[model samples]
Target chain A: MPAERRARPADAAKVQRWLDVVAALLRRSPDRLTFVELAEQVPAYGRGLRSRGDERWQESAVARMWERDKDELRALGVPIGVYPDAGGNRSRYGLETHEFYLPFVHSLDGTPARRTGGPPGVSMVAFSPEELAMIRRAAGRAAQLGDPAVADAARRAMASVAHDLAAFDPDADHGETVVGQPLDPTVLRTVGDALVKGRRIRCRYRSMHRDVTASRTLEPLGLVFQLGHWYVVARDPGDERLKTFRASRMSAVESLAPNGAVAPPRGFALAAHAASREAWELGDGEAVTVRLSVAVHIALGDLPGAAPASAAVGPRARTRAATMQVRRLEPFLRWLLAFGGEVRPTAPRHVVQAFRDLAARTAATYGAGS
Target chain B: MSAVARFARLLRLLPKVADGTPRRIGDVAKALRVPAALVREDLQSLAERVEDTSGGFIEGVQVLLDRDHVTVRSRWFRRPLGLSADERAAVALGLAMLAQEGPAESVPAIQRAREKLGRLGPGDAAVRAGRIGPAAPRTAVAGAQRETRYLAALQQAWVARREVELAYRKPGARAAEPRVVRPWRLVSARGAWFLIAEDAARRAARVFRLDRIDGVRLRSATYEVPAGFAVEDVLRDGRVFMGAGAGTLEVRYGPAIARWIAEREPHERQPDGSIVVQYPLADDAWAVRHVLRYGPDAEVLAPARIRELVLAVLRRMV
Candidate 1:
């Protein structure tokens, strides 16, 4: 076993300072920074605490600190380059300006930093205030629900737009608020990068259903947020078979290919994959419509797959029967169970049986007596 | 962050360029939380890496410094990374569910995402996207035009952690009943939105259907919820009716109903394939009304008060 890291408050604050120092250095351009020059300008880099002649002490302490900071920054994706100093040794460090930025596109809107390019019609049209807000919100929502890095990326994408982070409608997610489970931002960003680049990713994935973790190379396809969880559908590069993996369950994520590693089929749409699904499918099962005895005005209006087929007036408004088309019986049953006594299945005996069994088991949890 | 993580972030910020327009070095520095010098080095290293390494992925990728702005000259440098159509769709779908009850201000964002997905990639054909579930927020859809005010008012109170005066129509009630509640959490189930709150008058936790909530007004009074106030306790069996019976409530279902009920629900199954369900009834009256949906297939057998209530209701039906 390895030793546990002794976490300290300064550890985090130090990272921010390290980032700031790097930013300041990049502005200097092809100018190489020696230890003395760096420490003088960026106090965060920590200089030789003593005098200039103390080479041994400075090399052991300050140089070591600088070395570790460079590796840490690199681990975080900072590209620090080393050029030869006056002594012709690779001692000075600097950044190459172009590699760190996106392909610069000057937008008519005048947001100089905004990155934009796609098919012609895509970029030619200008977005209305509302449209931009929606796109930004969608990106914002992804950050809110997925990971911190995801949020940071979204913030960067919308750098041109001036929107407050504490905007309304974000806090109150009027729909399915499954705020219980949290996702690892690192995992989200890794797969996100893979998907964008059309690259394969080697993932240390923990399959909750199978209760196993294994390393597998996957061709990143697309991500879908469903039923309070985010799921990524990836094709097994080896088999060409696609599988949906829960985002939260991914233990480790690493991109295995570069952008454009795999050019997806000429025209592949993720919505098509998502659109054909029955809300109740639950991965396995044949689609079947079941007749349900649901109350009138129950408002089964727009649940995923259980749409209202027909309605029957009952003795009481509460007992009105409604037939619902259930593509996936399991999710449909779970959905019905929420209604409890207000809904029951009368026909398509199997669906009815499933609904009753679920209800009975739920009722039995309280124990027999009352 | 590990190297893989950092590299992934770097990729998102690096878009492929066709034109020679310069991007702000500060933008990359600020976005990645690294210094501009570090970004410059990273870019230089990356460009050199492709030039040095054999068979690099991107073609003719070169980073150039132009005054304060930096741009890449690459044959294939596109947006460093783009969210696939599916990702955008997933986000759009989730937002659509919330849109029902979400503020009108968020609609544009929802619509914008939808349009973006449409143009994301060419689908083989226009395939209908599959949905895992839908959030049919009651007030958002039932009377969408009229309920915006109610939705915003209730959401305001919920966010502020204040008391709310809601005119809620109890099940089967003709008109809404006025009550003050300490809002806790909002829940969605079976295409409907519900608020699990502490009903001041009842002095207990209760789940009120959002649609039945006629009008809601935020109160200035703020209240602290008791410790460990998870909704699972009240949502047990997913029943919203408040409990009234003290002892257990047993319901015996006929074979047809038993077989269906016992399939997954935990219950005491009989030798004849019949099943018995025992539940801690929230309200005896509400329970009676609930069991009535099973019609003649189910009967409440225990807790004399509940049995009496069921019998009285049955007699009235006849």
Candidate 2:
């Protein structure tokens, strides 16, 4: 051996690379092949050690290398066993399929990915083909979301995961029902990175309320996608309240202090923040109750805060009355107006008057004097 | 890759050789594309770890070396492969959303996938994954169930590479007529779904809206889509009916509605906060209906013919 057995496989990165090499050699062999035979069959191994003179090409070096390879692969969960000389043959070491494979029987949860801790990471669990295809769909969605880097990462992850299941029997059929709105891919990826890393971001955002387009630094808490749009729920440092910003309206997204020890305030729930209110309702203001009579043919189920008349209506009725709250008056008015004459504000004389004034102008635009 | 990640990969590699037949370290390494030296070390290390944790080889796993083949013997190794909880949840959410989202014909497949994933049995933590958000609301689906049959039929034709007989109705047409088509791809844009296929009668390509496809039936014959055909190229080639043409129409939006248009629609904004939404109109009547959508918030300043058409619709309505 050129060197002592002091080298450690603690750095799994390097070990990971070596593990790939060893697994490759073992997988191609149908029967047990000795370390001596391995050194001869593997061109790279012999060439690498011989070329670098890193280790003397001898029995001691060979034995030491064998020991280390076993340690790293074993660390990975491969159960490699030694077949003792049964009929006066040299002891051979290899992985026997019956002993190494962990076939899915029942339990979904078991060993942790790592014996140590960080954030929650992957620990293998039984996944059907349907589960895999579902993951593939998400990866596809993430790619379409406008960022190249994320797209590449998603593509790679999908490929690697799909590769893991290549040896398994077909589990299920993957369908084509997938559909999702395209988003600014860059923003989705950037915000997702920030949310996971507890990073702050600086963005030049165009506020929906005003003409102001300025750069603001915020601590992003989470991301929410609604109605084909992506929004980042974030908070200004030192501020207790979180604000939402449409990702598309922001530009020059840059992360700040990725390594800084930061996290959302204790118990900050991303799901709650995302689903608490519709994006339009994120505007700051006092809520107002308003009633609207929409043409009977128009469905108000998707409208915010809309509830229909509980009882049956007369046959002659042309409209159905529903009530909802309004906070962002501009957006609310725009939405109501978009329905044209099919919608009418029936309560609050001031709001009604406002709607009437807009209606008159619209009527005039069509040369139908009001 | 951390030691943990390596461990995870190691676990996955187990099933590759858990059959109890001793495999050569060299052969296993070659198949898995690893160095034999490393494979040898991995087995030895794992054997000890499993032993220490679960009372040495006899309890759960066995690792040994005989005549250079590293063999393992464990009945439990035949277990199904593993995925993380977050990963499972993400997959579940994707399946749920795809099922609810349009491409409605695909719902059955998505449902099957969901069912299979759900079949991991009771006490399965994946089943406990909270409700998944839809990719897009069901409004598009509810807007027209009449179009679903077309979607399903065409989808079948597309998957099987077969020709289809389509009863397509034009945007303003009152009736649908049968037209044979070689279905190619189904593409989505700006909240609308369009089927791109070769029109056998015209011997050219056409883009038909899902709603406009009043009826479809899979034909007996199959089709071979031209190799390397790109849907984007075809759709961009004079297929986008409402975009880019010889001239741009000039119209202004009121301050109240202009911001909304500027925010959601493509247009140019004026210094005074008004927005001009430009459209390349093929005809004045089309322009009139499009602008009338904004009601009084928008006006056609030029093309007197277009203004007259708008007045006709409004005056008639009043």
Candidate 3:
């Protein structure tokens, strides 16, 4: 193989990273890039080496890099062509960003997108000193007990209040006790770590449905804090299945030896499995597909791209689509109902029927008509 | 089903319509390529909804025909509002947690919510004197969001019963080429995200990491997730993340490290304030870094060979 071809594998990511930087820059500025200027503008290249004191690019290498960039641009199928601006030795690269740039326009203004627009005529309420302290202290504690993201949010909210205390005008209302929770570093870090690493962990888990403490070797897959408690998607070793464990109920934990050394079956994916009905099961079982629909409102939030990928926007919306698969059906539907009518099953007619049947049962218990 | 419906069907969309600007009916019609009347009908249906617990009617829907504008608004109240200080704190923490999504338009939301809440209180410095909890390190939240997206995508694909094609890179692999496969499930253990899926090319369910999936695609074909397949069971049967252990490994933990260990369950804790851990001697390597996290607080106690390994690590660290 030629030197260019031989070195292709090693240089691809650097090339791609460079290309990403270039693309981002082009998308932002949409101007030509001089070789020297390119080096100065690209983040990786721009960070250091301002002077280009010891620049090393062979004539052949520069040609190769150009060819690679050309191929990459062609792959995008846009009419991106480089022109030697003036002399053969000098060149400027340019691409029309209108084709590639994503126009992200804010639909609303900076004013509060208030989901809960407090009572009309209620500009603000005032709290007593004791109430204010209680609210701040409570928020701090809640942040500590929750996930890192939530804790961070709580911290920011409190900080904003503290920073703008004069603006808040605490005297608006007096003697009103404000409730809050502080962030708990211990629990947040623990679940955070488990979710980041695809490792099976042991925890003294407590379930909301039952107050009993049980030791569980769990493969934590996801974490969500809802209704004042943290929930973890863990693969329980005892029964060999995934279950949502409440972090608040977890009294203690005892790590164990890594699960035995065996390979997961061919084509086995936890995400795919979680989407399957089988994922809801806390016991070992086969995978099943669980189809459901989210109401348009919930859909925006739950569907892909509603919130920034970096935000804790509930569960991550699957770009591929919204359906869920798992090892069992019952648990998945139970969680689905948390959204009430906002979500409905479209496939596995049996699953939908089951949900309907359960709803009917619930309605009957309350003596309500369908 | 059409690809749009098929995609929608596979992944359920649960509407979470909190108070926000409703998309213009005309815009929805244009995007979906439907008639204005049809779009208006859909909007009307949506506006008629009184499904929430509050049972309030949807009002304030503004459709300006002349301006070709549309907006939906509803004034509904959620109940059980008298939150205790603890509950208020939890909500505040949840709001703080919202910051992890990155600085989106939501920053304004946080500010507004704070302002609204602040206005409810007196401006007395002493009244608002208590310190707010320390903010989580920004890097931590950013990292979690990045990881969660990959995990969520993998999980969504698995749940949708749709095949996933991914370009994966494994550690120590000479190449970082794209590898396509059908993703089945995602699991996170030890602060790392792993995807367990079937490698279409290999025809086997292989374990991959979220950080390693360079590209992900949902195949069109519907898959039949075997009624009895569970991702958790597969991992427990020693199928995921554990390759054949290559060598004996041992480590010790001090009190300072024990709490995190207890949190992570790296080993079984004994009543005597000690913990014991074991590893197979064939499939796992390149995990030395993970073992060393305990630092001097950990010492390898069992298996002379593994003990020596721990010592070597300590020596290197020293």
Q: Best candidate per DockQ, number?
A: 2
Every model's TM-score: 0.46, 0.56, 0.29
Q: Per-residue CA lDDT of candidate 2, range B282-308, in tens? A: 555446645665667789876776676
- Evaluated against the true structure, the overall lDDT of model 1 is 0.53
Chain A only: TM-score of every candidate?
Answer: 0.54, 0.57, 0.30
Question: Once model 1 is optimally superposed onto the true structure by TM-score, how far is the C-alpha of residue B121 displaced, in angstroms?
Answer: 18
Deviation (Å) of A163 in candidate 2: 4.0
Candidate 3 differs from the real structure by a C-alpha RMSD in angstroms, to one decimal, of 30.8
lDDT of 1 by residue, B91-146 (tens): 45434544644666766656655665344322322122111111110100121222
lDDT of each: 0.53, 0.55, 0.42
In model 3, the runs with Cα more than 4 Å from the true position are: A1-370, B1-146, B234-249, B254-256, B266-274, B279-286, B296-318
Give the alpha carbon lDDT tens digit for every residue of A247-349 in model 2: 7788888878765744677887665566535433655688787888876655564365687744666777778888888877655664566554466678877
Alpha-carbon shift of residue B120 in model 2 (angstroms): 11
What's the lDDT of the predicted structure labeled candidate 3? 0.42
- Shift of residue A167 alpha carbon in model 3, Å: 46
Sorted on TM-score, best first, the list reads 2, 1, 3
Best by TM-score: 2
